[model samples]
Target: MKITSVIARQLLDTKTRPLVEVEIRTDTGHVGLGAAPTGSSVGVHEAFVLRDGNPAEYDGLSVHHAVASVTDHIAPALVGAELDLRVLDQKMIDLDGTSDKSKLGSNAIYSTSIALLRASAAAAGVPTYTYVADLMGLPPVSTVPVPSFNMINGGRYGDLTQPFNEFLVMPYKAESIEQAVEKSVKVFKVLDQLLTEKIGHKPQVASSYGYAAPSADPREVLQILAEAVDRAGCSDIMAFALDCASSEMYDKTAHTYELNGRRVSSAELIDYTRQLSEEFPLVFVEDLLDEDDWDGYTQAVAEIPKTIILGDDLIVTNRERLERAVELSAVDGFILKPNQVGTISEALDCYSYGQDRGLLAIPSGRSGGVIDDVVMDLSVGLGVPFQKNGAPRSGERIEKLNFLLRVADSVPHCSMADVSALVKA
Candidate 1:
């Protein structure tokens, strides 16, 4: 497909935050729409999320610069270009020529890159995942990723009194994607009911992941998840995952984390994460330490060998950063956020790198997402061992989850990544 024109629009994501979406039109008359969802707890190494105009306006967050990059620069740069995914994406990166995509915002570049992927796949008349798999030189395996269900949210997502950001119900033993989602939903409901009975009312606040409850205790969350899984009659089938988002809590200057008013030292936090991993059915943990705390992650990952130590902020979806983490043995896997690196191809490279190092590659869509199903295809295309999706309630979250279900049905030999050994390890 020959690229024709590119356009950018400033839209609001599910969290009512400024987001940039790109629409790419090709000579084939196919239009591809792509979205980049911003997160409140972003990593320092992540590509600059730029804002323009007055600081007082819209919290000093605007997409005018990003929009201009797409329409004015990006659009002209590739108007008559052939949509070889790698070439097209690299053109944008080259145009910027910076490590963190400071010239054209990562949001602008990624949104456009994603839209190009979709448009090219559409012109080829194949499933988006299949096209991506071809680009990655991987066999088209219909592997349903292990369900890393983010069933509870804390920190930037909502109710930051709780130090832990995500309470995940991992359906490690589920036989299929359908069964996995079922187990997740049952546990979520059971937990909701338990919260209602223990507290005054059910957690009616719907977060990006799951029901947001006002609690700051990780032990309490662990206990509640166990009870909920047992009550749902799936104790053996489901385990827990924690996305601590510790960078959100870590005070860089003080070098101590504040948890519910207590100043927690790095050693204390690592000890606590290890404690929770051992005491609970925690199969996976992400960002348990500050992003820059290399020693802290090394210690935590060493102690929690059985649990999959995943890195989000620690790696920031960059292969160069992933190499540093590997050298330190700081993490076992990565939460691949494409926008963090400004290209799906780069994100795939990180995924491939993780695979060569015997690391888990988890393609993740941020919580405050959109209705676009690009993440759904990206997860399937990468053939990740796991894909982190949000809770069952939010309509925005359901769109991707439902699309996964449909993808599973479309592919003949769809198989889910079984985390049974990791959970029991």
Candidate 2:
């Protein structure tokens, strides 16, 4: 098949956030779909390098210069040149020791790679996951319980206007869906109380940006959450997971991170989580510190009870960094994001590695987009066993929830009827 054209679109997710979608068309009528950066000020233009009838091919290549080089210098060589899309991988060795995955920007490289992979898969008559598994010689994927996060119940932090958001704790399992709903309700109630105690008001849910405000102190916040869990209607809520995306505030650089106009560092933050874990237990804590502070992360995890210390931005979906974190004993879990790493295959590779090392895998969605269905599918197809999406509300959050609900209906016993199953593992 010959490469015929490459097209892209930048869709606004919110006033502050936008996501790039790209399509790679082939002469044989197969089109590969992927996402890159979005927005003019961001690296959107430099993300995709096209060689069709357009002169703006190099506009945004700075964000993904290496990938642009591949498309500009290498892809054309193979476009009308005729190579089997299946079984056709340009390894460093095969590229005459030239191409390297390390040379490309994280998002740019991932998007481009997956676009090529998907186009190839479509041309070869197989699902992208199946093609990937065949290439890796892996067994069929197993179905795992979907994980739902309860960030709606947390004290407010940061500027109320900022679009950024964070998930407070992950509850992995529940004996029944009703129990999960009840637990969620309590968490929100506790979150409200925590915010009222510290900031003097209920945290407002922003409609324009879609993030909760008051990014309050993690300590008091988790304590309130722990109390809510203790008082909630489910005896079986214990089996659910605990999310700690708030763990990263410790460093002096990002220390005193804003929450409801309050400044907090990692030291002041983690104790509440530790106390909660000791009292109620938890499944995982993601982004406990700025990515560079591996020592602090390791120390905190060791000190924090039996819960898993997960790395999201800290790990960044790179194998080398993840391996380094493992060697340093910095994490017990990984929050996988395809866009963060840039491709479906790379994310899966990281997930498999996490699984092999006995680390918990939590597939997460961007808090900023409606284009998250593919991520949900990839998480299930990869057998992550647990997924972390947003609250039961919000358009982006609801998008993921709807997909999981449909999946649950399709598979009877394997449904997300309980959140506790995710917690135990």
**lDDT digits (tens) for residues 1-425 of candidate 1:** 68888889988888787788999888889878898887767899998876675577667677878988998889999888887778989999999899899888898999998898889888889988888888888888668777677776775434457888888888888889898888788888888888888778767564565767456788887787778889999887777888889988888899998676588987888778778877887878889888899998888887776688889999999999999999999998888888888898898888889899999877777755888657778788877767788777778777777777888888898878765655633
What Cα-based lDDT does every candidate model obtain?
0.82, 0.53
TM-score of 2: 0.70
What's the C-alpha lDDT at position 79 in model 2? 56
Q: What does candidate 2's lDDT look like per residue over 1-425, in tens digits?
A: 77676544444443233344546678888878765432211112122322233336433333334445445544554455443433223331144232223343334344445566677768888766546556556655334444556553333334332112344444445544344444664665655666567657665664322225444444444455555556554334443344444433233554554433466555544665576566555566666565666776788777775667787767766677789889988887877766555455556677778778987767666654455445665665565666676565666666666555555555555444233444523
lDDT of 1: 0.82
How far out, in Å, is residue 88 in model 1?
A: 1.4
Candidate no. 1 TM-score:
0.94
Among all windows of 10 consecutive residues in model 1, the one with the lowest summed lDDT is 151-160
